[model samples]
Target: MAKGKEVRLTIVLECTTCVRNGGNVNKASTGISRYITQKNRHNTPNRLELRKFCPYCYKHTIHGEIKK
Candidate 1:
């Protein structure tokens, strides 16, 4: 982890079984998810990247920026 760059990320593993089985019943914070999805969809922030994860889902999702 980078100094002063460590962040809290919430992610989804895209597990269909989890979704169908109600494993993802709990609502996760979608802040990072929305940001990543937007950037990935538009292909913006080219080359700029950041690492994030969802502790609940145990997914290693990525983001463009880290929040304080």
Candidate 2:
């Protein structure tokens, strides 16, 4: 078997508040804000959650890693 290239994995962080409050007509949102970050597969093999700033929400919220 050929050796595979060792590449670091990256994930997207999305705001939970923006997704939940997206269905309202009166709400104003350009869209859900996302942040890209990298993680070491050997160090952490599970999903990651981070507190990030959401322009739409105007506050820091728990951003969860989402599948591509």
Report the Cα lDDT for candidate 2: 0.78
Instruction: Give the residue spans of candidate 1 off by over 4 A.
Output: 1-25, 28-47, 66-68
Tell me the alpha-carbon RMSD of every candidate: 11.2, 3.0
lDDT of 1 by residue, 1-68 (tens): 67435343332223332334455434663222323322342334233454555444466544343332
Can you give the TM-score per candidate against the true fold? 0.23, 0.77
Which candidate wins on TM-score?
A: 2
RMSD of 1: 11.2
lDDT of 2 by residue, 1-68 (tens): 44334446877888887778772313655578789999777787798889999887788988989996
Candidate 2 positional error at 45, Å: 0.8
lDDT of each: 0.40, 0.78
